[model samples]
Target: MTAARVGVVTFPGTLDDQDAARAVRLAGGEAVPLWHADHDLKGVDAVFLPGGFSYGDYLRCGAISRFAPLMDELIPAARAGLPVLGTCNGFQILCEAHLLPGALTRNASLHYVCRDQRVAVESASTAWTGDFTVGQEIVLPVKHGEGRYVASEETLDALEANGQIVFRYAGGNPNGAMRDIAGISNEAGNVVGLMPHPEHAVEDLVGAPSTDGRGFFTSILSKLVNA
Candidate 1:
């Protein structure tokens, strides 16, 4: 079978598309570079919206990015069962696109936070998280200011009931996200959005002792390969 082609989108000011592409290649998939202005998805099997200060984080991290021409097709494609993973600023785009729920606000401390953080896998049902066991702990890096996630009590309750909360900070909360929520998934589980930088943790030589983040890429690749 041909290797699954994973599209990594690069918007103006995007900082991690290259890293995401490298991780995709390392996971045995083809990395297809996607421009923000392109209308086509280029026949990729899956897509990743990498973290970055797109549009220089002008109005908000992903506010401007959500309106990009590519998203006009990408959003519908994702809703049609195409696997889409959004990290950090990408996560912000997901929220902005309404593909995922909740809004990210400035950190409670009012400062940009960057660090190696521990997060518990709250669910293993998503395309990007199937390799992890429920309650598994993984280390990844998170860098952002408007990383704190907030929602109404009703929405929080709905997310908890549906098991859409995918990851939670295992130790102390880094950005004061409500209930330590670090990541979440859509109801179908094909789309996932997280505040951490998994691409940064894929290499053993560069990141923490364990290559926990590699599972995210491998999990999606395995799913596509099996399908």
Candidate 2:
């Protein structure tokens, strides 16, 4: 059987495309490179937006990249039920594009934090989180200055009621995000965005504290294969 084709979108300043691609391959999927300036998806089964300072985070993290040519296609597809996963800077893009609710902001301490953080999976029903179980804890790398997530109280209540909150800071709230939110999914559960760098924690050989991040890639492959 052919491996699932997962497109890894690369914006001008994307820094984790290669790592994301490698994680896809390791999860038994083919990683297709997607250029931000292009109009094609190359028939990928799913899309991944990796971490980085897109457009050098000029106006704001993910602000400029939100209007990239590729997003023109991605936004509709995501709304039409194509599964999408965005991490770190990619998370910011998802918000800026209005694909997901809430926005990321500067850490309360006004500092960049890079660490192996523990997150508890609160909901594993989403396409990218299916390999996990509710309450499962995993360690993933998180590095960002503007990573705090903020949303209206009503939005937060609705997300919680709908089980759209996927992950929460387990050990500590590194960014002072509201309700310790580490990740969340859209109302349809197909699009997910998080502030962690899962691509960086997919392998043990790279000195990652845990290979737990591999589940994100594998889960998407399973979703595509089953569908």
Model 2, position 197, has a per-residue lDDT of 83
Model 1 misplaced regions, further than 4 Å: none
Q: Worst 10-residue stretch by lDDT in candidate 1? A: 204-213
Please provide, for model 1 over 1-227, each residue's C-alpha lDDT reduced to its tens digit, 9 standing for 90 to 100: 89999999999999999999999999999999999999999999999999989999899779999999999999999999999999999999999999999999999999999999999999999999989999899999989999999989999999999999999998879999998999999999999999999999999799675678899999999999998
Supply every candidate's count of residue pairs whose N, Cα or C atoms clash at under 3 angstroms: 0, 0
Question: What's the TM-score of every candidate structure?
Answer: 0.98, 0.98
What is the overall TM-score of model 1 with all chains considered together? Answer: 0.98
What is the TM-score of candidate 2? 0.98
